[model samples]
Target: MNKSNIAILVLIGILFSSCTMKKETMPPNILFIAVDDLRTELGCYGNTVIKSPNIDQLAHDGVLFSNHFVNVPTCGASRHSLLTGMRPISKDYLRNDITELTLTNKQEQDAPETFIHHLKRNGYHTVGIGKISHSADGYIYGYNEAPSTKQELPNSWDELDFDYGKWKSGWNAFFGYANGENRQSLKRQVKPYEKGVVNDTGYVDGLTTKLAISKLNQLKKSSKPFFLGIGFFRPHLPFNAPKKYWDLYDRDSIPISPNPMIPEGVNLKSLHESGELNGYKLGEEKASLNHPVSEQYARTLRHAYYACVSYIDNQIGHILKELNKLGLDKNTIVVVWGDHGWHLGDQQMWGKHTIFENALKSPLIIKVPNKYKSKSVNSIIETVDIYPGLMELCNIKLPDSLDGKSFVSILEQKNMQTDNVAYSYYRDGISLRTNRYRLTKYYRKEEPTIELYDHNSDPFESKNISNDNKEIVEKLIPILEKGNKEIFY
Candidate 1:
């Protein structure tokens, strides 16, 4: 018990405290990756057939939200919901041209804009490549016309970039083929599936990966922490990829949809005639509730879709490798997300405009630096929650008017019970999904005003048990009404 011994112990304690404080004060960078029209059909999600090693590894290293949904099923509206952290308050917000007239007409002073803009204003160097907003290159342009000079999300990023390569523009690159012809130039006569003999560079997603890697290298020298958004367009229409990707899948082994028929007792108005898939003039067959697609065609289409998913997974693998190579993985919060899910001949539908579980359920994986432990959460979460969640994780100032509640606590606590209900809208129909049931109501005057499906009994939603389950309908109607009431006033 000497004075010298007491002085030495106090000095050691002070040094240890300083090291912990330095680690806590350092801000982390962000790498946000968006994939288009991807579903929960990966090896990580327990789909044994499809091969997705890289994405699966990410899930193994990060936390996966098992039941993640979008506020809107379509691409533009869904991304708007995520970026703005709000639901569709107006008709314009529900459509693909989310910024076309709304941004110009509706002016709010001192209002918080998209999350990217907020990040940029808060000392983060924001950079976007590919389709972060409604447009392909974060700029507005018609699908067939030449590219325009206007930015879709103005003042949101320090740089907006895209590498169109032989396609010349972002829109063209989205639909471009191996032979340098796009659907627009071909007048929409392209087939729904194509296997090219060229390498991965023959596609637009490959070029996107190259540009993102280059940006990472450049950002490494910058003094401030960065927020980089990278979007990949694949597993979408005209499913085209390299021959090597296609070779990875055996055509005969691809499986068709287990629940391919239209749900019993469901109104026909609730479904559509696979319009997006039929848009390709060279498509062999038409799909409808009256007549489903042939099994052979379905298998072929599934094979192509799986190949595209594998291709995009490879591109993701490349970008993640580049991040680790640049030594950014340890200090960056990496997120891999799909804007919305797609239907591979589910419910006799081929696109993503429905309010069904197949169209709304997508993949979500978040990896925090030095905190990854392969966690999985089954609580229902919406895509709008991403905005506030990122802000909270980065320790940035959160603004008012955010509709999403942050889920950072869910990452820290394994058994946390998050908001169990997720709401989605498509056209005039609104659907709400709870832990065990999905209740949908159409605003239009239809024969069946309410459609209810018990997820516990029918996970595939093979039948609409609305008529038989009156008790469940009564319990869920009030919840839906309250959500509807919020849309106005």
Candidate 2:
């Protein structure tokens, strides 16, 4: 062959090699949607009642984890575990203010504070909207106090923003009512639920949705892979939504928890007086462990919560549609996760500060381009695993300090070799959840410090057979204690 002909062939080969390399080297964009106070009671999780069509469709297009649990059940703590990939190593780590206390006003350094910071270090543009951290916005403020210029995550986001709109402050908007009045302004005199005659833009979530859609449009033109975190306010508190979303559900058909009474063998110390729900002074009635709310009132509160879920679902639909229209869905890794689960009259409780299954289980849906399709992973996974999982999914290098092991294999191969266990911490108790059992141990002076519930016969956790199941407790305590790095006792 002539030298000129060989040189031309070599150039063609080099061009082909680069074309292949481009496909492998281009990193995927991340669309992370974190909802507050959500649980496994959605249409995608086999709830025929809740009108969560958008989220259900997300499950249809990607992977849904039916057995996912959080390490902590509160908003700030659970998200801390999620963002940092660490379990409750210290009692102080379980506080909602852990992020603000540990990370605020810090200088930049090589060691990333959170996983989002890690992504930022790796040449990704991170944008945050709404309550990605403990605060409604990224700013620091008390519920009744003025806002400050401090960041909860000091080095995480490139642009941290929240559109409080007419409410004037992020905290006010979070606990807002329809008429621009909020719980703080009203001195907590307002009811815990509201149905307003406004469009989707009537609430802050609507504004957040608009902002997210606009961000997606702008992000499509960026040169670097973007990590966009869109956090929604509802289904969290005050149960406020446009009247249209509320009107979608029939009040009579709203289902309350089947196991509404206290479990058979548990002490009253394990439960509480629904302190969080009772904070709204004008609530129809307070929730208590001894005297549970009436069935009729329970359905009413549940109805309001369903409305908020539908409202948030619509907001998610808007952002997802924008992503697809901008062609970002083709290379974007989308995640729909709830910070933690709320108790809608489970065990006669109305909050998430419990070590039960209902409080710890939340919805987690992940969609990767051209990978798993319409899949459901029932093996137990925890909130701590999300950081490592995302790192592996985005082809980024995994950090050795993360507490979670990657479940990316479980995303593809349904029946891979693995241990299906999840651990949760609340109060003085440490709990473990397996495929068929839930074991909890409290470090206190109580007769029934150990609680065991077999999910096979009682998925609602209505009965505790710890005394009868001593052998099971003996077998699972070591596994549970392994996760309790800092023992309370």
Candidate 3:
């Protein structure tokens, strides 16, 4: 062949390689959905009672983490750990006001160093709606005060927003009842649950879903890849939902907890007296281990919770449907995660304040662009691990200081490994979850200093067999101690 023919072939080869590189380098858009106080009680997670078709459908198309645990069980601290990709350093870090304090006292760095901040720096348009942080709209405000100008995560989002609707501010929207009365204005004398006859838009989460859907349309036109975080507040408290959702279940048919009593041989300090539930003084009889709640009320509470779950599922379904309609689903990575789990009268506790299995374990589902086969990973993984996982998924550079390691490989492998372990810290208690056991250690010098439960034998964690299993306790103590160093007791 002549030199001219060889030159023509090389030019064609160069153009083809350039196109391939450009396509490979294009970052995928991220749709991060955060649900509040959601437990692993959905139909997908083997709970045959709850009707969560939308979330179950998402799980059918993606990966469902059967053993996903959070760093902290409460809302604020759990979200703080999730956003910062760090463990709790002090007792103050465990409070609901961590967002208000941290953003107020931001470090000398030019920009906030949260994961979303890093994403913004990397040419992604980060938009947050509703309660991504402790605040409802990612802004700071008092209990009954108007929304302030202060942003909770200053440099992390391009646009931090919320639709308070009838309730004036994000805080108010969070505690808003069907009649626009909040827990504060009513002086905490509200009922524990409500069955509103209004539509989905009657509550705050419905408004949030509307705003998020609108933002999705706008984000579709952006030049750069986008990271949209939509946080829903239903299934958190005052379990209010449309009567349509309430009608989905029979109140009498809801199953009560098999083990309603406090764990045997467990210290009372290890459990709380359902303080959050007791705050709603109207029609609520305080529940305790000694004086257990009535079985009828327990069933009613469970019914309300399931209704809220289905209500949120409908909202999620709407947002996901819009994503596909806009042709964004092909290039977007969808993640539906619960900040932490909740206790629905498990161990006679109605709130999430302990290091128990029900409080720490939540639902986590992820769907990449091309991988759509249904898969469930039963390995131990922490909420902190989300940062590195998303970074790896989007081909972004993982920061060296992040406490979590990427689970992208685990997704590809589609199986659990023997070495998988998750660590969680709440107050002075430090717990570690392994493949078959959950071992918790409180920083106290007492007889019940340790609490261990074998998940293989007792999945519900009804009994604490710490004292009986001396050999297992000896083996897991050092593992739990490894994560305890970060928490200053």
Number of the top candidate by TM-score?
2
Could you tell which candidate, 1 or 2, scores higher by TM-score? Answer: 2
Per-residue lDDT tens digits for candidate 3, residues 252-274, read: 77899977878888888888889
**Candidate lDDT values, in order:** 0.86, 0.90, 0.87
Ranking by lDDT: 2, 3, 1
Considering lDDT, which of the candidate structures 1 and 3 is the better prediction for this target? 3
Q: Which stretches of candidate 3 lie over 4 Å from their true place?
A: 1-25, 107-112, 414-416
| Candidate 3 residue pairs that clash | none
What TM-score quantifies how close candidate 2 is to the native fold? 0.95
When summed lDDT is taken over every stretch of 10 residues in candidate 2, the lowest stretch is: 411-420
Return the TM-score for each candidate structure: 0.93, 0.95, 0.94
Q: How does candidate 3 fare on TM-score?
A: 0.94
lDDT of 2 by residue, 236-272 (tens): 8899999999999998898889889999999888887
Please give, for residues 197-255, the per-residue lDDT of candidate 1 as tens digits: 88888898998999999999999988788999999889878899898888888778888
Supply candidate 1's per-residue lDDT for 325. 97
Task: Kindly report which residue stretches of model 2 are placed more than 4 angstroms away from their true locations once superposed.
Answer: 1-24, 414-418
